[model samples]
Target: MVQIKSSKYLDFLSQFGVGGAHPGGLSLTMEVLKNESIDETSHVLDVGCGTGQTAAYLTSRYDAKVTGIDIHPIMVEKAKKRMKKDQLPVEILQSSIENVPLQDAQFDLVLSESVLSFANASVALKEIYRLLKSGGRFIAIEMTINRPLDKTEETDLQQFYEFQSLLTEKDWIHLFEQTGFQHIHIHPQPSQQQDNAVLEDYHFSESIEPETFEVMEQHFEKVLKYQGILDYRIFTCTKG
Candidate 1:
């Protein structure tokens, strides 16, 4: 495999046209949305929306007005194409979570699946808070460290995943509080050992860049190495 030197770990998944690039994937996303009271009048924002899978689902399932955003131009284009192909009325934009160009307090729901950890958590959370209407829900499924990582472990994770912080559950809660979120609830997910299966079943696009495979290899190695220490959690918070 050709070696790639990109620090943005998500670029690899994007290049391969991977949809639902998160723990539990689209199945978990569907399960979580089943509990949400979305309707045609509801406005939802999907942050770091890879290929617009969740956005399309929300639009088709709930008939909700959905907006999907990703920092990567390629991802945005792919998401737009996905919505177009599915005849979904979702808007796709290329933007960063820390600096979204949308109006403040406009969305009734903001969804982030495996997204916040890759960003400066504090700033990104504050932005999420700003974008949400009062009483709006911010739902995130993200990677969290089960215990404090040692220096070497931290370096490896940070370098491989481009993680801003491998925060523990408590650390995540504290940041949510500081960012003015209320009614916070966290549910830890059991680790499912299926990295190899996921890779094996991945539907690689014919146009996939060679560098993506190298990054995917690095991602797989780190995930296997840190399987014992890494965990994922779903957090639901309300904007006060």
Candidate 2:
């Protein structure tokens, strides 16, 4: 089993239990889901599902059979706790996207929100492909660099987020195609920072590390430093 080394930045997000920590946050998630062909009978998988916010929403909104998996222990625990409190019948597991412990062709939809870049995208994408039924959809909201970055620029962002590689829109499509995903589509996202910053909810852990505070501060700093270069894209494709 491949494990994601816990970086301070990732640890901070997990410890804080920040739902919608992805670029567009949960509102974007709702918008994306609205366009999908989901029903109560559909089986959905949320890879790198931090804290189960989206998983819970899937059950509440579409009444879908949802399962969420994350590599971080804290995230898995919090996600489980969330389901227990909400009384939602969502299964939360601690696992890696590269090698998920689930049967193939089980899910109608699989989602990765700001997640694939943090792990081996090729391996994870292949795994996602195996998990989805033929004609099922796979949605990803991931960071996409508009242009190639200078080594210094790339290193700064990569080191901070611990991403595998800074992928562009084209690079991502190539990956999808390589994984046999057909009917690839890039959905335009409404700028989350257009008028107001996306509203974020936090469930703070009991024990907070001082360094974790620095992680959040540095996160905001990187967001400012990178700006347009650190943008994200919503890619939706079908398995065929």
Candidate 3:
């Protein structure tokens, strides 16, 4: 009779070491980065970087100086292991994105993948802005509802994922504007492709609780029930 609720779902994902847990997965990530002006000299920070999938790709693909941070201990450990195994010099840190100990204006780019909704978006945005150099860009592929949800709908979904708030596209824009971000853009989401088994990105933990098995069922049910209402968007902006 065990079950997972709230942020326990995050623990489930972490224990299973799910990679590309973000919406649209790694294929979309590759497509999105193609538009960015990244190179070997650029310094990049991947906030809430789960298991370092994107971080590894950033290093191998663009050869950018990449650093990854996540609040989950298991995730941080896995990310570090990935770096060590691949011999990639990507620095991985275990820290909350809301108040990282990094200096101001230190990164050329900051990336958040399906992470901010689970955090205090306002606080995290400010910290991300502080970490970016002048004219530096910030991009996030995060949850974005198309419209507001009623109390029941809101409670059910928010409780499942432990989202601080379910933000609409407009709500997200307001947060960005209030955070003093400039040239904010909501990019079109790519069509979700099927998971490629050959490139499967799961690194299961040595042990998993029986309660965690119910999480995937409940998650699928919610996604089906909400459908279009639970969609996500790609948000891009710059710090002045």
Candidate 4:
């Protein structure tokens, strides 16, 4: 069996079996938003919108008009279903971060949480720059390595590393600057408290195939190592 990577992993994560947005890993994603101010009426683009949690939060908390895009079709479908269920007007699309299909300068707030690492970081940042109007804000909850890694460690974390094209914090900062962002800031956010109940519920869900369950079990161990390499950060950048 092929090991899950990129869009396939996202599709796996979107299912109820995985407890999509319940892991509270996105606490950092939420923290980044709390530190910034955005116009309620601004058109927002949520790149790599995993299951619509952040998009819904933006609409409910900031009243922003949200267009959420993800490479995973399953995620887009679930997000759309979630929005419809809540009577919220957010639009969800199945798309890629490397090649966003939206028109240029169409968004005022561009936000990505743990998403850009899944693509070419520089290219995604540049695409984000192109989409946002001047003076727009870009916020992300991302993994940033503290130092360069040895080849052994890199090989050990191949699946985790390949699933995300992670960069050191310095590299990410340089990319942000090069992409024409200003007033960049990065804040560390630790993982949320693990709820055994949530984990139990997730374990009991029917959508998880036996093979996927085994992969996720292995994946979690790798995630811990990856997070250790990169201090988890809530990075915010402003479009110039």
Candidate 5:
């Protein structure tokens, strides 16, 4: 088994139990899911599922059999609780994406939102490819760096997000291809206008751990400073 380093940043998100931490939030997830062919027969996996929001949506909306996996135990617990409360049948597991504790070729769709950049992208992508059945789809929304990051900016981002690797749009496509994924599609989300109102809306959870809060503060600062360089992308691929 591969050893996966625990991320304090991820721990923060799990502790706060944020429902829509991804770029476009749950609303965007709904829009993307709308285009996919999902139903009672589809077996879906939500990689790095946080608080079970997307998993619950998949079950309630499409009635698909959904399984969620996250690296944090607290996240798994919270997700399971959310599913139980909503009376949705979702199996939530606490495990790293690089080494998911599940059988191969079991899922028709694998969904990841703002997840891959934080892990060893190559390893995670390979695992995702292995988990999908032939012709299965992989859809992900992830943070990307459109331009080259200076040494200082790169160091700050790594420190703030504990990201294993930050890739450009091209880099992402290369990795997907190297992992034997085909029919790749990349869509970049429109950049949000950086305004005072948006910055003001940024708030840290009071319940977050003190250490996590400090990191969050640093992350917020960097995001504000380098807003133009940071990008969010949606990728869809198929395993042949």
Candidate 6:
């Protein structure tokens, strides 16, 4: 596990009223699910549902029943608060992606956003496969490496993103197939305007050190080279 040094890494969402994950949480989520024509009739399982952004949106926008799970207690608690604030009936739990506290085939859909890379991807895939109902849709926007990089390039990953063992597009497809997912659809995203002032404020002076800045730039460049490694990729799969 990568060292989670700052509890405030994502605290900007609550502090500054940003949508947090994926910036435009609800719209982005809907766009990702729209391909599958998901609606109020679906039951969603959100792996690593950070602050309940996607969960709240799913329930409110589509009237879907959503269950959100995360490994961090603080994140889970914040998600619960967000659900209550939005008047959504979302179930949030502090649990790992490898060992979710759910039964088999309980969900009509599964969603993950920029979270799976932190876990052992294979185990996470297996867990997602087990929890999803037959024909259930698994939709996600994840962080991934476009291709294998040299040690120097790999070392450019920031402390927070270091835990992410991003696999290539081929690896992603293989993992999905190996986990018993069928009819996989992958949509690659392109880089867009970046307004990282919030994150910059959080890091303050540390954000400008030459070495640190180089690493950060390299990270973004790598992501850009592969269409914003974490910013791109929407996948839909069916449980077999």
Quote each prediction's TM-score: 0.90, 0.95, 0.94, 0.84, 0.89, 0.76
lDDT of 4 by residue, 178-230 (tens): 88899998665455554445323221334656665556666677767667675
Model 6 lDDT, residue 153, Cα: 58
- Superposed model 6: Cα runs more than 4 Å off: 1-20, 23-25, 188-231
In model 6, residue pairs whose N, Cα or C atoms come closer than 3 Å (at least 3 residues apart or on different chains), thus clashing, are: 223-228
Root-mean-square deviation of every model: 4.2, 1.7, 3.6, 4.1, 3.7, 5.7
Q: How well is each residue in 1-240 modelled by candidate 3, as lDDT tens digits?
A: 212224877988898999999887887888889989999999999999989999999999999999999988888889998899999999998888888989999999999999998889999999999999999999899998878899999899878889885899899999999999999998876555656555569889999988888987798889899998988888889997
Computed on alpha carbons, the lDDT of every model, listed in order, comes to 0.83, 0.90, 0.89, 0.71, 0.84, 0.69
Predicted candidate 5 versus true structure: per-residue lDDT over 79-146, tens digit per residue: 88888878999999888898898999999999999998889999999999999999999999998898
Residue 38 of model 1 has an lDDT of: 96
Reference-based TM-score, model 1: 0.90
User: Which 10 consecutive residues of model 3 have the lowest summed lDDT?
Assistant: 1-10
Off by over 4 Å in 4: 1-8, 17-27, 188-206
Which tens-of-lDDT digit does each residue in 1-240 have in candidate 2? Answer: 546686788899998999888876788888899999898999999999998888888999999999999999989999999899889999999999989999999999999999988999999999999999999999999988989999999888888888885899999999999999999999988854432144466778999989888999999999888888878999999999
True-structure RMSD for candidate 6: 5.7
Off by over 4 Å in 5: 1-4, 188-207
Tell me the tens digit of each residue's lDDT in model 6 across 134-204: 88888867766756767765655544354555677778889999988999888655355345444321212
Q: What ordering of candidates by TM-score runs from best to worst?
A: 2, 3, 1, 5, 4, 6
Which structure among the candidates has the greatest lDDT?
A: 2
lDDT of 1 by residue, 81-168 (tens): 8888778889998888888899999999999998888888899898999999999999999888999988998888888777886899
Better of 1 and 3 by TM-score: 3
Scored by TM-score, the top model is 2
Task: Give the C-alpha miss distance for residue 221 in model 1, angstroms.
Answer: 1.3
